[model samples]
Target: MARWESGAVEPDMATQAAMATIFHVPAERLSALLWPNWLPMGELFHVEGVWSPENCHSLLDASGDLMLERRGFVTLAAGSAAVLVREWQSVGRAVPEFLSGTSEDIALGFEGRLPWLRDLEDAHGGGRVRRFVDLELQYANELLRQTGHGGAGGRRLFRVVADLCRIAGWASADTGHLAAAERYFVLGLRAARAGGDRLSGANLLKCMTLLLAEAGRPQDALLLARSAVDATADGPPRVRAMLTVRQARVHAILGERDACERLLGQAETAMAETDGQPCPDWALYFDDAEYAAQVAACHLALGNYAVSDHLLERTTRLQPASRQRDGVTYGLWWAENAFRLGEPERAAAHLSETVPLIESGFSTRNRTRFAQVRRLLHPHRTLPQVRDLDARAASLLAWGA
Candidate 1:
């Protein structure tokens, strides 16, 4: 054990299996995952406790320690993820206890800064904005500790903290801190529940679903997506549409074409039902362009490369100029699809176009995706276009480093 902890020796498969048994992890999961990847490191899946302000505070405190741990990405096992979602759904709705306090103005102040922070993240990328986001989260935590969860102000404060958690989680995920992201999401969900903000809670679940899907846990992602949809049965039409599209993306990943198309159609129908009624501030980002991009992603997952490419072009053009990170992301996706479509030259050209944008910004997620594309193009490295792309990508990687 000492040798394993010091990295001098790894636990053999038998030792790992025994450790898994002690940790309550399933044997099959241990076999499926690499050595330490099977270990359950966070309390996100520990659904044994009751949902309350105290529990939320405890989680928030633990999350601060989690932020300092730079361990690599680790996702919940499919069974564990399913259990977590079920526990989340079964927890009683917590209402903020009203006490003598005046924090409404303070909560509003935090709320006002959210849009600017979000814009910075979207424009510059998560690596640039993550520290700022983490600072905001810490501030929110301080407020929670000082204010004592009660009063109308307390409820509003919880909502603000939940928003901060969502942003922090997203930034962490973008910067390749997946463990921190998952913890933040769980804490945010608890905060949202404490504040009775169903919409925000649903959003957190949606974010978690996407995160799991990106981590190659589509089955777990699908479960969470379904739970989000069910929980938001009476939510705004646009929000419902957004969640449905996300579920469709997971279905596409799982190669369930018919289910994916059916969900996509449902999402479109929900969008048509939206009469521009004021949606939640968070849901407003799922506009026409965003919707098209999500649909394109679903198609990409389903292997409809040509259709995905067409929609991606439109999506990129429709994106706001300030959303440079998003533009670069879509451009990368386009390149991946091109490669999948057997057009290495086109793929190389697309990848070359994104290099300048990537060098100018900072997104670990985008950089990771860029690496994936480079690997895809490696076999044709001798080609002229591929050679040019290699040179450009090499410089971008050095800049990132």
Candidate 2:
């Protein structure tokens, strides 16, 4: 508090919200009190926690969104987490209901466009689309308070919020803002739980698992993946299949080949059960190509280079070019496996193709993978092809920096 007053520090979004709860005031009120110039004192005191209709409309103005740097977790105390959970539960009810459209209409409008937004993220990378998505989410959240459907309407709105949060979290992680992504994922799960949408909650957990695993915390990834499977045990078949695939990846990381294969088989069985059923919109993209990519990843981790290379070949061909991030990732994996197979020329060729996509997408996730590829090729830098690859890799890093 002293540091904050001294202008040497400021609370993060989570901290500010927590403080608001403790002070029995709204977060914006706390902000206004702390920084007198932020909002007119008379209006701030009158508005308190809830925004007036005019204020809500004005908040929708598309000013630039803030970008926060990533940080590791400082574990929440049990009591604090519980309080946080309660605060999240009240979010929908607390929102000021001043939107032009009816709640259902607003939700449907957002839902209808979400697929397009998701596709844009997949094609161009998170840095390009995150701000737009954030603005849309803020608008959707405000609409929740004004929805007209009673209990049913509230649940539907909450479901949409959950999905939007999940997408935003994915984009954050892809752009390397892991701390912000963690906050978004937690909020998404909270929204899902509030709405009694176990499937969406579990899906968010699976995404968190993927982020953790990719960031080199396999144990944390495994725990979250297991939680997802258990939470959705009796939920949608496709979602169960997706979570099980995540389990297999963690098993592979643990070097348990038999365990990995067992879970993979289970994942396949779960997927088969969904053959004639309509899967959740989020799980629809976890198709054969995605399955193959998971399998390739497991084998690659286990040092089964030949098998990984074969599976990656199929994955690369089957995966659409528009999903530039995934394409570049798969290409990097293929190149790594080729290098492990004593084929530097093949590796160099794959790296050459991947570099362009990585540059175009500007993904930190793919850039990190490329860094590993560069390190793997360093031993052979004397070769002309390796040297050329190294030069391109350096240029890519410089441009990103």
Candidate 3:
């Protein structure tokens, strides 16, 4: 695409007008001036056989910063930082959160008390393996700051920053940046401390448990779940429930069926206390569907596929459109469970919808889980839906670099 303000290319009348509005060009030259900065989303995405460079240039408004920010917000709006990172990865590049390739994360990253964010981004190049550890480091730092930074007002301040850290960490984890995700979880812990919110601390620990399980370190994840329980032994009922839900998943992943069932009982007890009481600030992450989805996932991991399917179907019904990334992610899990229970056609149907959602997010963490979907498709490549999904997965897997 040509630069929006550049006096280089000559333009047709319509193109000039469109470019002028996009770039704030002087009205006097609207008829004669070429609008250089007009790249479309498809072109910016570099979708193969989708759009020519010229068409892309025409579609974009042509301010590099504007273009980058627009694209970045699109990903964020979709509740997916992973998608943004993945697409950038696909292009063999790593653009900073501010969409800058010219600067290092530390020097120009988001200017809050988030030094850890930079560290998380710097740890990966092309998708090596996972960035969980790096994310944990950041999560730890954020928690430290959030839990005790402002004395009496510490909790409130921590609330603000910790929220960002949590989202960043979860995003990192969802995308398969395990190290980076872990750092965010740890940072969230510190934030809980700074805020003097024991409930928040417990929530962070629960997050750690989930991350550990997701990373296939089920034993360690189970230990983290115990720690979460111990940390929040005297905390709010809902907080306790969060920990139990987490523990249930960890135990299920470890194949400790008895322990997982027990934890599920505990989670139910905690949930029973929701008498319209205000939720703890840290627990804001979970609404109804979020809770149901976690429960369903735990069941799926435990080989109780029928119950899992029922719970998951309910969860999907309750899932708000706003939770697109999570909804899609969980939908993939449901499909996997269906496959396990011998429903190939349903699996294919789910995969067809899910592959596009995952692509839009480009999250490495979700991609790791999504590998299950890919595996299922690979075996049934002769099927139309399976072949289509396999191709999409292949394109995305290339970004795991």
Candidate 4:
């Protein structure tokens, strides 16, 4: 072992195979670790009808970078990354295997269920939607692994799968499962690339940025947000605006007021340019109320309590019925800011109003945010309204249990 470690000797093929078997890893993986330079090109990855050797090499290089940044955020694009273009070009050639379902039927099915599923997510929470989406993803992946479909049908199917994965990832993040969220985002990106959907991949990166930003790694979040923007530089106006909002959020986290406001203005401009252009299904939800919420979050982060309060009020009033999660979330923020501005009674009232929705099993984000509000109001626990609000929140939070 010492001699092998010192590079005085190399393991024979038989020994390498034995080592791989013992370690429960593929022989190719073992070889790459031991004699990487000595192995030929095709030997790098022994498996696959999916990715070419070049693609595998790119992914392998990316895995190294991801490992280094494991605790922080990892950018989706790898070295020499024209990932979307490459995946687009390689689509027909990469996998000749046929999938079972007609892409049209699958598409129709997805469309029929999407609205209901989204509403469920809003009303119930990520916990309710995640398992359902996860199962769909699993089935879609299995279909891709089969033989029978190819060409445009295959690409269409892949895109649908990608979209489902994106939704699943979003749900996971809503539940505060950041690690699971990252895995789904990565998988979703691969499926998006395979479908030649650059916009979808860019959106997944944006999701990652949001996840990292909320997890408190602002530097990493800023880098990922920039990557999302660069990836979709010339994409749809609404899509660009969506990504720009995330970038603005990151800037806010980093305390860059000027940069945040600049990007927010750019987002507003992009939204205006969207005009009559067909918005992607994924971006249809980026409405005025949502934009207002994003702005409020930025200002709230930057200590502009009064401005944020005005925006939050407008947002909750705009579409309270449609945006269940947003209404509850903005309500929590309003309460927090109210207390910050030395209005404990207003804060208690705001919290009181939002508590019923919080008990609706919507998202951990609302619950978590409310907990922070609770902490903020703790110092004023002697106040009757504050005491009542605390009891109500605690009871709501412990309802199912």
Candidate 5:
């Protein structure tokens, strides 16, 4: 057991089967799965137990530890993920009951700081803000344990904690802690459900959808993405547009061009309907520029380099300077598209513009993208422009090291 835990060796099939039996997992499952993947690791397996305050508290406790201790991306079986989505869909939207208290003030105070924390993350990246967000989530969890859940005050507190969990989950993913991200997202979904915050729950589902897509489970991702859209069908136009765009992204990944295009059109129409109307604070960031950038991602996946480049150009121009991480990401995408179009010089130029931003930013995800772009440009290294970009990227990689 110690050897297995320390990565020194693998358990043989017989031992794995025995262990599965000991853990109450079906022994027959061992033939198709390896150790750990077969283990019911988180609250997801027990999603149907109940949404009581006690269960939410237990989930918070487990997920807080998950964020701190778990490592690597644990791929849940596709069927398990589908089960989770189905349970989320069937869960009642009623707020849970709780002991009345004044935690509302505390929760409100935390809420007041969310926008600033989000801005800080946008400017600097997840590595810079992950610990801070984790600490906030911990504190919120502690508060929840103390205050109980489901009154008006408790609902507000749960919603605030859910938002924190959302940010924490994103930060975890940004820093390459995907297992932790998945757990935190599930925790946030539970909290949102407890609070009856359907919009917040939908947002968490959307985040999970993207995470799964990035993890190479587009089928599961598509299921969750559709669930997110269905959950928020009556939400504000901007929010609906944001979720619809995400669904379009999944369709693009699955090579369903017609479905992708249809969803994109719907997203655009919904965005147009916003017309300056009020939107939830969480949905405010999905403006025209962000929309274009996301659309560019869809086209990028569909192999429309020229169209993606055009949309990304507009995204770069319209993106706020304060959104440094996004600027770097969009710049890298633009570079990739340019290179694919047989314009190495243009690609290198755009890549060069992102060097400084990459230097100042702290996102592992962006850094990975930068490395991929570098590899894409490697064949053209004989070109003077590409050579220069290569040297610059090398310097950034060395600095990161």
Candidate 6:
């Protein structure tokens, strides 16, 4: 056929072109011959290593409106070459509300990826940040890749990665893995930096400060919290409030009531100006229950058992397990309050309850706080359960049991 023919068309060429495009097949280009002598459908999910274009064409294609979305699970999506999976299913299987089911349909043959993603998270965290180091690295790697792409989507992903890193760090600190928590905190800082969010970085630093405070290094925690506060002062009201509250927590740990109270007042002032000021992303975790609970801990540490008791009871009742049961801090709060109220039996009981959750298990942050409370109980270390718990707390008991 000539390139330009007057009122003449080649039916053979037109049919060949239409067939090639219709079935996603390679056509008569020189490069097509150099395509490694391999089939064009080498990337098929289940039916690879065979010429299956005819079979592929037999399968029904989705319409323009046919769509499937992954609400939270990114792991399953990445398992397939496509980031988004379309809706296509078979009979006799239970309809899954989440993206956790296996893909058995011929058109969608890839299985779920959420389990692998969760495995990666667990390997780093061993179920939480305090128990796993291997999984933390992998989780951070995944987040780093996701946040590398610039734009609103990148920022959104960066925020998620940042939150996960912070969670891991917090869990690490709670489980007594201070160094691992610190590493997570650093990665969280990097994630925040990727999104150019100073407030998020400040929040990560706040987490780090809490870790230090939990390690019985209130001075260090106070310093870190102060640095975060100073850096984020002009950024957002909520960010500033969170830093100040953390600083107050450090001071409270140090038994510096006056300084702690001042910081608490600052936090309140920041919170009171909610009319026009914007809340930084970091402070979203802060609320009335949190403030009250933290302040109660401060009082408990400072020997104000009555005030601490009131606060602990209120906070505990305020947020039930249906809402959040992983609050090792709340457990510590109740235990300390019981200890400070001259209730050795109750204190020991609370310790017994909180110990398994904090000492033998997760939360180095909780351990350190428990240790502090244990120190407070040192005056009565000779008591029965206290004697048993003193060993668990690793307190200053030099003599024989």
Q: How many residue pairs clash per model?
A: 3, 0, 71, 5, 1, 10
Model 4 clash count equals 5
RMSD to true structure for each model, in Å: 5.8, 9.5, 18.3, 10.0, 5.2, 22.5
User: Best TM-score goes to which candidate?
Assistant: 5
- Candidate 3: minimum summed lDDT over ten consecutive residues — where? 70-79
Better model by TM-score, 2 or 3?
2
What overall lDDT goes with each candidate model?
Answer: 0.79, 0.68, 0.55, 0.67, 0.79, 0.51
| Cα-based TM-score, every candidate | 0.85, 0.75, 0.60, 0.73, 0.86, 0.54
**lDDT by residue for model 3 (229-337), tens:** 7666655667778788888888888888998889889888888886575665446446667788989988898889999999889888998775566777788888898
Model 2 over residues 1-401: C-alpha lDDT tens digits?
53442234666767766666775675667665654222221111111222222333233232123244343221222233334334333433222221223544546677778788878877875756777777776776567645532365555566676777787777778877665575677666666655556677778878877766665667767777776777667766777888898888888988989988898899889888987766578787887777788888888888889999999999998997667788888998899999999999889989988877787676887887787787787788798888787777777756445
Among all windows of 10 consecutive residues in model 1, the one with the lowest summed lDDT is: 92-101
Off by over 4 Å in 5: 1-33, 37-48, 93-106, 397-401
The lDDT leader among the candidates is 1
lDDT of 5 by residue, 99-150 (tens): 2346436577777888988887777756557778777877877887787775
Q: Per-residue alpha-carbon lDDT of model 6 for 24-106, expressed as tens digits?
A: 66565423532212223211122111112222112212111111210110111112211111101111122112112234321
**Candidate 1 vs. true structure, TM-score:** 0.85
Clashing pairs in 1: 97-150, 98-151, 99-151
Q: After superposition, how far is residue 220 of candidate 4 from its true place, in Å?
A: 1.5
Q: How do all the candidates rank in terms of lDDT, highest first?
A: 1, 5, 2, 4, 3, 6
Off by over 4 Å in 2: 1-66, 69-106, 148-150, 397-401
Residue 184 in model 3: shift from native, Å? 2.6
Worst 10 residues of 5 by lDDT: 92-101
Candidate that beats the other on lDDT, 1 or 2, i.e. the better one: 1
> RMSD, model 6, all Cα superposed?
22.5
